[model samples]
Target: MRIAILGAGSIAYGNAALLASLGHEPVLWSPSGRSAGSLANGEPLVAQGAIEGRFRMDVARSIAEAVGSAEVVLFALPANGHRMAMDAAAPHFKPGQVAIISSHTSFSGLYLARAIAERGLDIPVVVWGTTVTAGRRAGDAAVNVSTVRAKVDMATIPVSAAARGLKICQVLFGERFVERADALAISLSNLNPQNHLGIALCNFTRMEHGETWGQNENNTDSVGRLLEALDAERIAIAEAAGYTVRTIREHYHLSFHVEPGPVGEMARELAARGNGGNGPTSTDTRYVLEDAPFGLYPTVLLGRLTGREAKLHQAGIDIFSALYGRDFAGENDLLGPLGFADMTLAQLKALVRDGWPVEKAA
Candidate 1:
């Protein structure tokens, strides 16, 4: 399969290497053209750890070149980049081509759907609850993958393309993926926001001080308790909305290969096991910036949609906004322009199912 990776970050490099290892033609494009310079040289992206290889990948000089002949365009960037990627790829998307968000955060698929629909194009979007591989950048040209997940959960927008999208992903990655009912379940199933909230709150000092720290090892019992509370609220909201979201414990056991233990204990064990790398060294990182607005804020909005109280989810957003002196609530490009006040939960679900109408000229 020909795959176009829409980012040139660590995860993108790792995924590009993995795809190349699988004998798929993987091409990379970075928005800033930073990684593209190095990648364009055509030295194989060397990968180590869980997936080791010296694999060569093509680098697209522009977005048009990237999506031009690709069968699947994977957004391997962070949550914040989803909008940019969707916007850039919209014009080039073909009917039979599939776009998969490495992990769905908030309503990325819906936003992408709206963009494509506005252009009168129909593209199937496969949304994964989390990434298939977890790794960090070893250097400019290489990445260290800790582990390839045994299984990852996913769902497809419009709910009709689930089977086709899943088969494409399975064939490309050779990993098991459990398909859910719709994109809602897949979005809620993402454990990053709630998990990162606990990590950020508990280890605020380490992040602020710019100190070296292990991500999983710092998941102390107190932090675990808070994470559980946040998970409870998320699960409640999911259940109220008639979606099944996996608990944080189940996520840890499955995704991280942790044994039976408390969330905090399991985190520490996973850290000690050595696949888990160092956590974010700064507070300005995605744990607060991207996850708060894209992850937790949407979760809080979902709580309101379901008439469930997500005090922690709301409180986290407020705290971060105040701490950063930025209105985190307004950061979601996906939902901000949608006029949430005028829409009902059922209407929103319908929009997700059918798709929001294309915006009319003013």
Candidate 2:
């Protein structure tokens, strides 16, 4: 299928490389325009790790042209670019177009639903809990994937369209796709933000002190315990909301080659498997920025509504915000943007069960 990857960062390049290798002609476009320009000019996209392949790409000037004939539009962009990217791509979206937000955090499908409603068009939007684990970037229209995730869990925005979404994903992602219960369930299941929050909270000083510091080895016993506390909060929210979450042990097994072990034990297992325990660990991590807005905020908000208090999760947010001297909650307009700001807890619950236009907005 013809595809368009909307981000030009490392994730974009990496995934684009895989698609190209799989015989899918993927048009590369970025808001920055550099990655697209580079690919369109017959530049070589460099491949480094995992699957190695090189190829040039067709680049488009606008989101419409980028996704003109794409049956599936895959967004490998960061959480920060998610909604804005959707708005930009909405004008180009036509009927039956499947837009997948990989590794999404936040209420992304709801945001997309709002955009689609605003445009008066209905399109299927599938939001994945996270991307397929592979990473890459373009140097000359080729990509480098250092590592790859074994499987990914995803859920559709409206909850009703999950079947259709999974069918399309299967054609492309194959067995990498695991159907989640719903978008809210997927939102909570995502561990990137949660994991990053723990690491960043513990290593903020390292990030502030120097760029060279690595927090890959910072998962101390206490840190592991804190991570468990946060995970328990997440699990509690999921259970209250009527879903069984993927445990930390299960998470470690997938992200790394280990079984369901403790956090610190899993870290050691990852190193033993040669993944090097080198996931994102810095101030620039989305755990605080993107996930907090897209991932954690939703978790916190849902937990409150679900009769669960994510104290450690909340504490992480508080400390991170204070250290940065920025109001993380205020920085994110997720609830407001989703039109849930004034809605009561009961009202939000109904919205999740039913799709948009839930009531006559007063």
Q: Highest TM-score: give the candidate number.
A: 1
Candidate maximizing lDDT: 1
Candidate 2, residues 1-362: lDDT per residue as tens digits?
88888888777777777777777788778877665566677776657677766666777778888877687788888877886788788778777788888766677777776666566656767887777745534354555575667778887767777788898887775767788877777877888777778877777777656555434456766777878888899999888888887987787787656767678877655555555434453567655777666667777887788889887777777887887787777766546777666666666555544546523321
Where does the lowest 10-residue lDDT sum fall in candidate 1? 353-362
Candidate 1: stretches off by over 4 Å: 356-362
lDDT string for model 1 (1-362, tens) is 89999988877887888888888999999888877565578777889998988987789888999998899999999888988888888899877888888889978888787777777666778888898888888776889998888879988776777788899999999867988888888878998898888889788889999999988788888899999999999999999998877888988888777776778888878877875888888887888889998999988888888999899989999988888899987888878756655678888777656555445411
Residues forming the 10-long window of minimal summed lDDT in candidate 2: 353-362
**How does model 1 score by TM-score?**
0.95
Which ranges of candidate 2 are over 4 A from the true structure?
134-144, 211-216, 276-282, 344-354, 357-362
